[model samples]
Target: KGCTWRTVSVDKIVTRDCHSKVFGDIVQATQPPACLDACGSQKTNTSSSCWVDCFYKAAAGPDSGKPGGKVAGMSFAELTAAWEHPFLPEDQGGCPPVKPKPPWFAHTTSVEQKM
Candidate 1:
């Protein structure tokens, strides 16, 4: 019961925030439907869409006939408009900086002598 209530509360908060003008505008500015569709088509796993992949492909600049080229059926202008938000300066609303990977530690294998 408590878990269900907490889930409902979180959902309501998210829905409310998403419906707000500021958040809605940001989402619309960043992820247009066409861009999402294009990325969805390219996904290896069709069950779910990858927003990160869509953002990268959409921000790939002009069409160059490459695998990750501009989305099909979408003009350069349209792509650019949809891609505007992701390219914004960090202070404005751009992607956060990537964290460095942790150092790798090798595991030691012990050899057992025959009894």
Candidate 2:
């Protein structure tokens, strides 16, 4: 059971990473490449809502400067769905609720120590 749970967690991480990479690629192709780094730096700006928000604005915002309201062959709605899919509620056909760590859990550097 524990192994299965761990596998699900790993799968979620991999899926999130893949989605992020795809979003970043589309942002890079449509906007200035340096803008990607700018989004990273904007982490301090609470209003910006992190790199994802910045990238989303750049790729799909009204002033995005892309013709035909598309990025990398995906419509704005399609792109948003793809980028935000992993975070949607499970009943809405998204990932399950993340399991919280147990109170007794702790990392051990040596096998001699109890977990």
Q: Which of the numbered candidates is closest to the native, going by highest TM-score?
A: 2
Whole-model lDDT per candidate: 0.42, 0.54
Top candidate when judged by lDDT against the true structure: 2
Candidate 1 segments exceeding 4 Å error: 1-74, 100-115
**Using Cα atoms with residue i matched to residue i, what is each candidate's TM-score against the true structure?**
0.22, 0.31
Alpha-carbon shift of residue 16 in model 2 (angstroms) = 2.0
| lDDT of candidate 1 over 1-115, digit per residue (tens) | 5554332321111222222323324433444567556555554332344644444443443353466665443456755544453444457654433443343533433454322
Worst 10 residues of 2 by lDDT: 5-14
Candidate 2: TM-score?
0.31
